[model samples]
Target: MTMPQMPDSPGTARPFSAELWTAIDPVYAAILDHPFITGLVDGTLPHDAFRHFVVQDSHYLRDYARALAVCAARAPGEDDVRAFAGDAAGAIAAEQEMHAEFMDRLGGSAAQAAAQPVGPTTRAYTSYLLATVYGGSFLDGLAAVLPCYWIYARVGEALLAKSSPDPLYRRWIETYGDEAFQGVVRRVVALADRTGAAATPEQRAAAVEHFVTTSRYEWMFWDAAWRRETWPV
Candidate 1:
């Protein structure tokens, strides 16, 4: 299928800096602290909670795939951009297929799950990503979505460390703790660094905004989930 196209943009660029990393650190930490996310690692999360998580994640990935497709379409014809797009396509496919199966095994049905609307935090974060992919430079799009990689890696490592005895959590950890998944995160980080290396000041600012906005939304998602608030219609 033909991928969706991003809106046209002027071909401008930017440079990466330590400040960007520093700006995103708190966001990284907050995602790590998300109760539902951390619960996956600690094996303390209820199965129903995971069921809810998986359902929401499945919904999120659908949008994520579209966002990546937009990124791929916007990518420059250069080798590095092409490589990033190719890797992103593979990553999105694996996430969509494997995670869906994992959820199925956990008693989630694709039909029922697909019908679930994205939670508020998920909707906001993904909308921002779609906007970046369509409207921002390629590097900014990379920055906008890179936090998922970093957060997943962190969560996977913690889960692996704690994986044992608990069959349920073991299954969860094994899915993300494997070399293949880690490789995906590593590849994205490298892409982010490379893309960031050439980012302009405006691009950097945009990246920071994307990072902070998504990160804050991530924190609130967990908070809302924990409180069992009825997400807005």
Candidate 2:
């Protein structure tokens, strides 16, 4: 897809992160209208579906944290290094605490949930992310991971406007919509902007590709959960 360019004055251009968003805005809009998301907003999503999502997401977060740590190690700036490290730790904690609570509510422990087989879509998405981060540049890693941070914040804020009636759904929405998570996402975006500004044209194009690929994965993730995706073999 051709990226939509934002209007800019002479000698002034929009942040690369803004360009990334513009490129994915169509995907984002499609995600918002997805059955999984619509169900979350209306409290019509099945408990089993949410449980599957939580379990799969727990697995995803663990590997995502590893990718973030890689980014931390590769970061040129000390501040970015610290920021990525902190975000890595946060992903680990979110995986443990957030998923654990939801797991329990769904009548299982984290251990039990972890023991469950990884769904096909979950495996594919996480594998793609890990491959991108481990083999790619810092900007590439940021682009690969940005969708998880940015999309969740956008979805949370959107859902918060018409919060779910189901207490469980509301809890999930509020977790992402809360001020602290929002701040975390903003910092990541700023980091992306800074890193992307210095990137060469080829690198910038690669970042855009990674960003779009992951954004598609983000949509696939929710759809997978909604469908209770499984290995066909």
In terms of lDDT, the poorest run of 10 residues in model 1 is: 1-10
- For each candidate, the alpha-carbon lDDT, in order, equals 0.66, 0.89
RMSD in angstroms, all models?
Answer: 7.9, 3.3
lDDT of 1 by residue, 1-233 (tens): 11112333478332243445567677767767777666766567777766666666676776777777777776665655575566567656755676677677878666677787677777777788788878877777777776666556656676686774557667767766777777766666666657666766677678877766665665665665555435656
Candidate 1, residue 37: lDDT: 69
At residue 125, what lDDT does model 1 achieve?
A: 72
lDDT of each residue in 1-233, candidate 2, tens digit only: 11233576689867998889989989999999998899988989999999999989998898889988998999888998999999999999998898899898889999998898898988898899899999999899899999999999988888888899888899999998888888888888888889899999899999999999999999999999999998999
| Model 2 alpha-carbon drift over 4 Å, by segment | 1-11
What is candidate 2's CA lDDT for residue 61?
A: 90
- Assess candidate 1 and give its TM-score to the true structure: 0.78
Off by over 4 Å in 1: 1-18, 77-96, 221-229
- The CA root-mean-square deviation of candidate 1, after full C-alpha superposition on the true structure, stands at 7.9
